[model samples]
Target: MTGAAAGTASRPLLGSAVAALALAALTALVASGSDLVSAFDARFRAGADRAFGASAGSWLGPDGPADAVGSALLGAGLLTALGVLLYRRRPGAALWVLVGLTVQFAAETALETLVGRPMPLPADGSAPDPGYSFPSGHAASATLILMVLLAVLRTGTRVWWSCLALGSALVAAVGVSRVLADAHHAADVAGGVLLGLVVGCAVAWRVGVRSPHLSGKETR
Candidate 1:
């Protein structure tokens, strides 16, 4: 590859690697019970509860409206993208999306187990969700799936920009919902977003290299 081509290819890989390193560092810090992280979590949780109150939990909790809407949106987006890729005869791109999601979920599960961080109590003093919560699965899934969709539709068009805005909004909403539901610490959501970035960038790199047509890049 020419220098420019190589650089273009390396950018996504480099981003993925950096995100991976940051995620690892955050996981280690959380696992070690860092006082700084703990303090920050406490303060953030307090502030969120004060600002949103217990009522927010009813609408943002795991079984709430936000969760339902986010799930529906993600599912529809992925299915639609898969259909389009298949129709375009870019089965490789579709396959990569499935593979990326599998990897993202597996990574989150492993990290959650490794960190063993418990959920915080809700503002209403309700029972916390039972599970290890270091990296929020909801946040990670939203980030990864929506980001992949964004990349697939990123053609520098008005539609692409609209999708970008919608995807960004959904991701933010999902992350905040998890925090408001007391299902994760603010740091947990951050770690999840970072984890998603790692997987999303890696998938994008693979798709771009392996299927330039899908990535809208000229094949060399």
Candidate 2:
């Protein structure tokens, strides 16, 4: 094969290998991160308890900035904004948005039921820490939201690289937020980010390869 053709053939393989490595890393982080788990639980609970001065004090405490920022990043409102932008720039990104939300929500509900882990808060509480901690639904959703936004941006190499940098930062921020809020352990958030990155990357990569404009652009 010609050099260009050979390189093209290797792209998917390299991508797949990288994807697999990320998955395994996440799995390990989730399965064997007890120190992080203890640290997240203690620090978050202490911070919340200190700030809130009660069981549920932190819900509307000084963490307002973090909550507001996290909500804007992780909420349906933000998702809607992202959807609108993607619809205008790259409609295929919309499909991934739907898919990512559906997968995370459905899996969280089903697994929480199966594992029967209780939330740290009440049933009707917005911060219910109950259900399975294996994967944090909030963190998953937040991380995905960030990735989808990044993916939907213009797809030149510069844009793609920029998205990668910003998206990674956003995902990490959300994960940390969950831990700081005492809503989830660090391992839980780590798992959430891992799952999100893999799922989001796959979906966004498909969109990129299939996008008429993006696919046609050559990277120097």
Candidate 3:
């Protein structure tokens, strides 16, 4: 490869490495309870506390209104449905989507275990969850799947930009829902975003590098 080609080829690897480092740093900050992180965590939790009490009368009715959107089952179901739908027409895309989701889930689980962060209780004094919480899994799930969809649906047109905007909105909604439900701290959601962005970018770069349709003639 020419020097320029070599540089282009290495870009994905560099991006993936940077993303992995960012996730590790976030995990360390959360685990060590560094003063700055701790202060931010406290303030973020306080904001959630205020929102929780204020939204009690809303349609979600205080017992986790956002449960349907952020639940693990729903996330899995959505991904599965997409995979099934795309399997026939785009087997590679379907397989890669599954691969991305698996990585996202496993990383979330491992980080939660390692960090051992606790979930905040619901405003109504519900029982504390037994599962570990650090990076919000719902946020991660929403982000990963949405990114996959965007890549698959991308057409190098104005419509592609629209999809990007829509995907971002959905991911943000998932994160906000988790906070309003008192299921995660703001830092936790932020970690999930970072984690998802890295994983999603890595997956997209890998796919782009491999597929002529994505990286060559169809390039945007």
Candidate 4:
């Protein structure tokens, strides 16, 4: 809150803003060329083999929760409640909700339609796809879930380090499972991770700045 401490803290914010701009620019540039886009589309289409590539991938990978009622229960019932309950701090909880919403939007709407990438298919050559594939929702939601959990638990839990370790591990495992299932590409997963980290950290930083107890304690 003081002059020197504030200056030290603002550096990370400045750096992150710069980095986000850079990534946005990079993603934009990659999307501008039709020839390149066509090439990529052709590759994915050609590379996708219904009987083997896509089918094998889907089978090998972890099952997705999009169609599963149980998953919705877990996310809506357990995760949402946990996010609110664990984060007794107002700023932190609000930040987490904003981050969660952002992750969900990027995964379900913006990224999905933007990429229009198809999933690995069955032996009958039927495609299992809703829309684009530039970013994976499963990976994004999984990351957001853990990120929220960590933020919610960070200030309250005595064992903050363990919470972080467990959260990160869970996110990574879920992402790997999604990939193995042929639900998403490695690039899509990476995009999801980056999106989650940026939004989650921004919320965390803003919350930490306002938290009296975490004024100097949070390294985020």
Clashes of each: 0, 5, 0, 5
For model 3, residues 44-162, the per-residue Cα lDDT tens digits are: 75665576556454533226556565674446645653764365365676677679879999999989999998886655566766777799877776776665555554446775687
TM-scores of the candidates in the order shown = 0.81, 0.62, 0.78, 0.62
The CA lDDT of each predicted structure is 0.74, 0.56, 0.69, 0.52
RMSD of each: 3.3, 5.6, 3.8, 6.2
Q: What pairs collide in candidate 3?
A: none
- Please tell me which predicted candidate would have the highest lDDT against the true structure: 1
lDDT per residue for candidate 1 within 3-108, as digits (tens), equals: 6656665677898899999998999899999998988887776776677665456775655675566556557667766886777676887888789889999999
lDDT (Cα, 0-100) at 95 in candidate 4: 49
Among these predicted structures, which one has the highest TM-score?
A: 1
* Candidate 2 lDDT, 1-220, residue by residue in tens: 4565445434534554574577566555445544665576667657655654554444532244555655565665346646565556655577667786787677656544554434444313565543456567667676666655644455456866866676666666665556555456555666566556556555555554544444444432
Task: Supply the global lDDT for candidate 1.
Answer: 0.74
Ranking by lDDT: 1, 3, 2, 4
| Candidate 4 accuracy as TM-score | 0.62
